[model samples]
Target: MTSDPEEQVRLQGFGEMTLRTAVATLMQLAPGERADAAIFRVRDDVRLAQSEIAELASHWGIEPAPNVRSPGLVPDQHWPDVVRGMVREAPLPSLMVAFLVGMLVARR
Candidate 1:
């Protein structure tokens, strides 16, 4: 299949990087409790993924995912700081693994 260049992402490398990290977060959460605080974190990552994808998709005149938050939600002081910190301080997938380990160990 031919790749569509118009659909390619070029501008926000950070978005792509964050998405890769979010995927790992999701996989790690698959077997866990929703009550665990990290599940909320995973949701945040998922929202970030959606937002980045939406921003990219919007330029193409496509209808982005419905659940994607308003741009304001992220660029704000509280959320953006944490999100950026997560991207900068740690690899998302690895963080999820550590979160799961901590939760599992704590339960024992």
Candidate 2:
């Protein structure tokens, strides 16, 4: 919320850089690790909710869904490599897409 356009652009660039760095860091993590992290976050959230609503905790005995492995065109393990290859092959298009997404998110 700055009056200066240059300052706004600088801040936007910083935000985009931070987002890109976070994405790159996540991409470096193994798929299994990512899944585990997501599960942990959900577990923490559920624990917090249960703590806040003690009476509802008893009703929240939901079972986890069974893991059904579906055959994908590209196997799970190679996904990160394939995505990296795609971005390497078409850097400009990827950057444009990222920029557009950032703009849309910023507008919101």
Candidate 3:
């Protein structure tokens, strides 16, 4: 809530860095009894952060973009099914992308 624009930008940058660090730490943790708990904690934190960001944006008169989808695109409600179908249609490519993402995240 700093009035200075530079301070606000710095704070936002720091928040992003912190979130990325948390995700990187989570990725490094070995899978075990604790991993599920950690994942849930991160998920909740992310949800909270998202809500906070939305509130802040609204306060600043920044409206979110409309959810516009082109013709033939799957509806928002059917995203899960669409993703499943895509994976089913191209499992190898999906897996490769997933692997590459994991590697990139780990590198961070």
Candidate 4:
């Protein structure tokens, strides 16, 4: 029901976490069941799509976002047109990653 796209994504992430927790609890409660049985039970009871459990497991187990690109190696082109505009009259350093990669270009 939110008009904000960021809010909707946050809500969706919260809902996914709740569902994952519930499924994990149920799996733990069924002590005698096989791992595959627990997966099937979750699929049948919660009506999730095929491979979604595996996908969720993979996603949840992933490490936090990697530092793929280094911050110090930013292109020279961004220094002029983009980085100069986000400056505030404070001591905080400018964040150029979003601007260098075009994330903040259209918004400005």
Best by lDDT: 3
RMSD of each: 18.3, 18.3, 17.0, 14.7
lDDT tens string, model 4, 1-108? 111212211111123234445344433432333133332222234344325544554555522233335667755666665546646533443345544657667767
Cα lDDT of candidate 2 equals: 0.37
Model 3, range 1-108, lDDT digits (tens) per residue?
211212212122124333333333333334341134221122233232434443444555555444445655744558888878877888697789988999999999
Rank the candidate models, highest TM-score first. Answer: 3, 4, 2, 1
User: Which regions of candidate 2 are displaced past 4 Å?
Assistant: 1-75, 91-94
- In Å, residue 102's CA in model 1 sits off its true spot by 0.4
Model 3 ranges off by over 4 Å: 1-5, 8-48, 71-108
Query: What are the per-residue Cα lDDT tens digits for candidate 1 across 1-49?
Result: 1123233221221233233333333333323321131211222332234
List the global CA lDDT of all models. Answer: 0.40, 0.37, 0.43, 0.38
Residue 3 of model 3 has an lDDT of 18
**Model 3, TM vs. native:** 0.26
- Rank all candidate structures by their lDDT, best first, as comma-separated numbers: 3, 1, 4, 2
Q: TM-scores for all candidates?
A: 0.20, 0.22, 0.26, 0.24
What's the count of clashing pairs in each model shown? 0, 0, 0, 0
Candidate number that wins on TM-score, 1 or 2: 2
